[model samples]
Target chain A: MHTDLVAALDIGGTKIAGALVDGHGRILLRAQRATPAQEDGDTVMRAVEDVLGELTVSPLWSGARAVGIGSAGPVDASAGTVSPVNVPGWRGYPLVEGVRRATGGLPVELIGDGVAITAAEHWQGAARGHDNALCMVVSTGVGGGLVLNGQLHPGPTGNAGHIGHISVDLDGDACPCGSRGCVERIASGPNIARRALDAGWRPGPDGDTTAAAVGEAARAGDPVAVASFERAAQALAAGIAATATLVEIDIAVIGGGVAKAGEVLFAPLRRALADYATLSFVQRLTVAPALMGTDAGLVGAAAAALTRRNSATAAGV
Target chain B: MHTDLVAALDIGGTKIAGALVDGHGRILLRAQRATPAQEDGDTVMRAVEDVLGELTVSPLWSGARAVGIGSAGPVDASAGTVSPVNVPGWRGYPLVEGVRRATGGLPVELIGDGVAITAAEHWQGAARGHDNALCMVVSTGVGGGLVLNGQLHPGPTGNAGHIGHISVDLDGDACPCGSRGCVERIASGPNIARRALDAGWRPGPDGDTTAAAVGEAARAGDPVAVASFERAAQALAAGIAATATLVEIDIAVIGGGVAKAGEVLFAPLRRALADYATLSFVQRLTVAPALMGTDAGLVGAAAAALTRRNSATAAGV
Candidate 1:
């Protein structure tokens, strides 16, 4: 790795994806390991430490400067900590401090895992070269980030692009976010599986009831599967149209495990957008897939570090 | 007046509003006149000439350094010209040059009327102190502007906050923005009035059926009027919810004549937003009213000029 490279770490509930990214935005060194996520916050942090130790010992990484971490949920980017919803034991965890210690006191910046993935896409994946766009990860959960008017919007509390929680139905299911009929309740990956299971399609295993499985069943003419994806598509389309109207995004890039269903998810979404979008100024929009795969988080963290570095230089410190 | 004050002119289809605002964000002088909107382009420009002429002659505004004009409909802010739909024959009218000659070589900046209103609101109105918000005018024709992350977003074509053209229902109505089922077709003042009248509710003749009359009737316990306002309220609410998901706006400042119905329009609108929003992050939104009333345009124009002056200064002019 380059001597002045920035180290990036992706922290999730199940695993860790780490890499060293260069100035040209390419990954030169990498490491992966299981997360001690079921343990207390300290144990999970120790796991991150072990992985960073492995990367530094490897010959591939000659040198590393600072560190960038992408942590999960309700992040306070300015303060550099996170208490993600899915990760039960990490309430108000000082993630940046943990990673900084793991990297031997190297400066580190923390952002929400979802926002980091989107930043990765913008840096070198599907959304590269585009200034105004939205990046969504439709995996175990529905989450997103936005580069609007060429700037990132992390919100007052650093959770601006929580697209899944936007309610589509007033009389629909109650959500954990203290609302009813949110897009996540009706259309997220787990919800999609639940919808099929409720229709008695028995996809064998609960784990087998993925968005891709539903798409396949729908392609095979399963009414239940077709209805399920259409509902998801409709909710997603409605959310997209509303967002486009407000920010005038030029493109929307979708990623994550569920996005593997592809057109089953996008086709109906486009049709729904056409129905609700009345402005003829921009007759069509470009809604497609994210270029970054699983490594999105690591790269995004690197990018975040780079941004901080630039700001620091501009400030003459 | 500040020595470098710019004369601002806002020519809507129905009326002409002008002001000589100093660089300190103060309106030093103001005036208004009826617009002979039915007349052809040249005839209408003659009216603009007359109004601007009055501003130059006033003892409080004679030494203006530059000029700015705001108008409704498809405008090329870069080109300083427009084709205002409501102003009968204003097709590609040389509005900037005409005003420049009319004001004797004073430089001018032209923008969509919506952008101007947004600038005004952001500078010092209902949306003051907000980093992200929308200032919407739901009157004779729907218009709005977006303030995102503390800066204005005018888009590639200078129409970022054109909320009226947003399509909430594909099966809805036709809009002149060249699309069908636009929000304006169902939620604008004219549509509200026309729909109210068509439903057999006779409002006092005020040249058009409008949201104001519908608001009045709803206050008086007219079922039909209440339903009409509720319909518009629902549509506006849905649109606002969609917007919340994308931009993470903290507030939506409702202006224009129709918004004056206060809670008659706001109450149902808030309920609809609560029902339609999909994200937990986006649902925490607030709605308010424009503080400047009809004077918003003049104030907004001066605000735009002030920003331009600051930018030019920052650019070392």
Candidate 2:
């Protein structure tokens, strides 16, 4: 009855990672496999099974009484399914059932990858100790999750804090999600680089055309690059402020590639936040960079599994 | 003891109302008085006490177990103070302590008026049975509250869902709240009327330039008035979609003066929602008019008090 470890899986288009994590979040064992994202559903499930197979054979797996999954969404926690946009072959994949079968009927908890990252931040990273917060990953695409009332609010379908899709401009630009003026349409790393390129900011001799290169140009005082970042910052500020105005969050933690731009992103974001977070209760909101790094998804999955086990135990289930 | 009733107070700029409400949300006895909003702090407190006095004098008062106050914010449930914007004379007034002293020390619960109305909607009105919903009032100002995981989300300051001030158009227009293009600035009844008039819509022979008049004109095929309502609908849709995307609400219930515009607003709102709420998870979101009437504030306050009483009882307090 010394069940102090949880099994965790981080499934995305790029990889399928599994781990056995201890009570303090240390990974006792870890395994990963490249995802054949374009393959059939069964093939993807097999890769996931292979990764889990690695962890399951380890002695530490015996202590893992429950399993948690952080999968690319849109995830339907109610239906125990996921249909990640980047993985076209896995439409409505029954991930929870697959994982449960692979793990000898261990209780499996599934959440969107963004929600998983938020759980990590809330449990041990930038959002730690904050009762109400928003944790975001601004990369090639922007994604996020919310921590409300000292708990991770993954929502019914496990995609509660998808802030990137929320319209901040209402009429600015069309997003692939079929929405107009979405934060992702204007604020994602790809969009920032695109805006910079469109605004006549050429890449250096290396001919790199990514947001990271644009960040360099911005640091060197390139007006077009700086303006692009400023626009992205504005969109982010509006979205973050809107979140705070709606839910009264006190902090927003940003991670991912775009957030690595540091003060080039933070300075303008702080300025634009004042313009949008004007309501009295929301005026004191702050923003910080996320600290959980690349292992957030794995650790957050373990955290979710632990929380489920604890709650079930408390309820005498 | 037969402690099944709660005292409810609805404090606003225009009125101070009180009621003795049964566990079933029915108002058994009521009292009301005009709010001398411009008067000093003590005067406002006296008006509230007078309303409470009427409820306390009734023979049913002995059955009231607790008190709930739903006041125009910014009300700080944590600090037990309220500083309603329209009531400048009562800056940071300790209304909770005042009510506590007046009610002979009955345990009290305080919430923003928007939260109170949401509680009413969730408990007995349009949002009944929906675990996750946003209830909004779209009259002189747009205000809202959220129901998440089957409980009211009033936030730490009792002002979580102040969606009116959220910027839908971050750079469009200056708002009194210092935000640009806030939902209230574009969608409130006053703004709707102003937009109609500014766009060359004239009043009828009655010479009334209210939003109600504009609604009548739009119904009569006046393009200017119709266009203004459409604009307001667009802003509302963006804000509503943002709420759904961030929190995964299944329904949005709208009430108050402007909602009386009916199809003139709802038609365009539904169309715009289809445009903004495009994510797979949010696509199923529905919009409805609120069923609770003016008594929502009172009923919702009672609902909060009853919930508090029940939780306290469960905790054996």
Candidate 3:
């Protein structure tokens, strides 16, 4: 039979999105609901079911042989549970079983959101054709994932490439995650905005004090605003260089809101990378912008489901 | 045919040791030579040839099915060449080709010294049952390798886990490798001794100025000596935590001279690890001493050869 479709779910603090994705990565049907992030566990589960309800009612639902979930982490693929830092309502929640029952007992695969984005990048974006790569999202938090030896390395608990929390500055500031000098502590978009505002860079008529505003001020030749991005770039370069040095990745793909700052982040990032990645094997590493858009999470989840199905078929399971 | 033996070579800056190892990782025959490290390329080649010559004459040589060489960095297994920093006479030297010819064209594998030790540790030491681990040698230089997904992750160039060169303090002291504040720069034995001496810690009547003496002083309650080890421990902790956060290893196995300091180094390391490895996935990570002694490289090389031979046999090649 031509069971080539996969059901994908992208669960986050802000939204719960579901889609029926075909083998060519096209979304044939879609549904989404605002996450009841502050509600109780069953309330959040109800929102997830609502999205899945829409998906299952679609004419294309029967073609989906498997289901994949990309949830905000930390996820325990081994336990088929997730306890995303933002989703306190669902601590160690049985997401796989919930989704399995919602989809008529379809085989389910769960991975961290960062890993799902990496799968998308490896399959059809900036990291395409690269055997070893790092794909990052530098937005509210600096999350990332790895592609090692031409395959997605989701790690034992599906959180292998959690680069945001890795300490680059051992004696620097303390992170809310209880670690000091984490990359997310220094380089995330919120940190960038905070550093800029702390340095006396103010918002214009719009009264918007976001990182995007700082990016605008930096592009318009504001020294303090530029310096904040430079500092963030430095932290990112150190973290990226550390990853390359430890794992030998040939490319790094950057995406998300902060990455939209363009050369303000990239120019300094590239220059600082040269300063840190000095070893023979890692010196040749390159950085690029991510091509996958907002649909990356859903598409990547579908890719994961497709890969699992293919592997199980190959194993005659 | 039993095919119960493999020829193993552990090439380093100070010595070239060779052995014929049985299938159970026992060394039944051995050869050794002082490395002509400062001589021309041909002289060094001659020393290696002489070591191989002794192994070739052993009565059990005919039973060897493959050969493995574990040499100092930076090695390029893809190109079959090596350019160890201490051995400047052999820049991109064709070690693999030469060893292949010396062994009468026996299938050969080459890996960095750190990777070789990791293979040994995974086979029969501290990391034996762990599917993912980082094995480190903290001596004059800090070197390490990774075992991921129950296999040695040598990377494309056989140098994936060169952790010493990754910078933890991006703006701190400059490293000789053209990076700033690398783990090796801050945590190596030489640096530990230098920091202790610079802080006015005096040697005993024996005038022993090594890290071992520093360890002795720290054990004897010298504040200066303890502070120096604490600083080294901090750098190591940051580096190790960074590794765990990026790749998700469950344990870190430490060996070599400085690791011999016991609680003086490990106590501070474990404490500092709690400060950096705070993420949920990495919080459970443990540190242990490597069990393989001085014969790690040779035995690990033998393990690599055996694994390769067994894989080839399975492939019917």
TM-score of chain B of each: 0.90, 0.99, 0.98
Position A118, candidate 3: lDDT: 94
Error of 3 at A74 (Å): 0.8
Model 1 chain A TM-score equals 0.91
> Relative to the unseen true structure, what is the C-alpha lDDT of residue A256 in candidate 3, on a scale of 0 to 100?
92
Global lDDT of each model?
0.75, 0.94, 0.93
Can you give the lDDT of residue A104 in candidate 3? 94
Model 3 agreement with the true structure over A1-317: per-residue lDDT tens digits: 33699999999999999999999898899999999999988899999999999989977888999998999999999999999889899999999999999999999999999999999999999999999999999999999999999889888888988889887787889899998878898899999999999999999999999999999999999999999999999899999999998888999999999999999999999999999999888889999999999999999999999999999999899
Candidate 1 per-residue C-alpha lDDT over A177-271 given as tens digits, one digit per residue, 9 for 90 to 100: 66666667777888887888788766746557777788888878788888888878877765565556556666778988778887777787778
- Using lDDT as the measure, the top candidate is 2
| CAPRI quality level assigned to candidate 1 from its DockQ score | acceptable
Candidate 3: residue A55 Cα off by (Å): 1.4
Off by over 4 Å in 3: none
* Candidate 1 ranges with C-alpha deviation above 4 Å: A1-4, A52-66, A100-107, A167-176, A185-187, A190-208, A217-231, B30-50, B53-67, B76-83, B88-108, B140-142, B164-210, B213-238, B264-284
RMSD of each: 4.4, 1.0, 1.2
- Return model 2's CA RMSD, one decimal: 1.0
DockQ (C-alpha based) per candidate is 0.32, 0.88, 0.84
Q: How would the docking of model 3 be graded?
A: high
Query: Order of candidates by TM-score, top first?
Result: 2, 3, 1
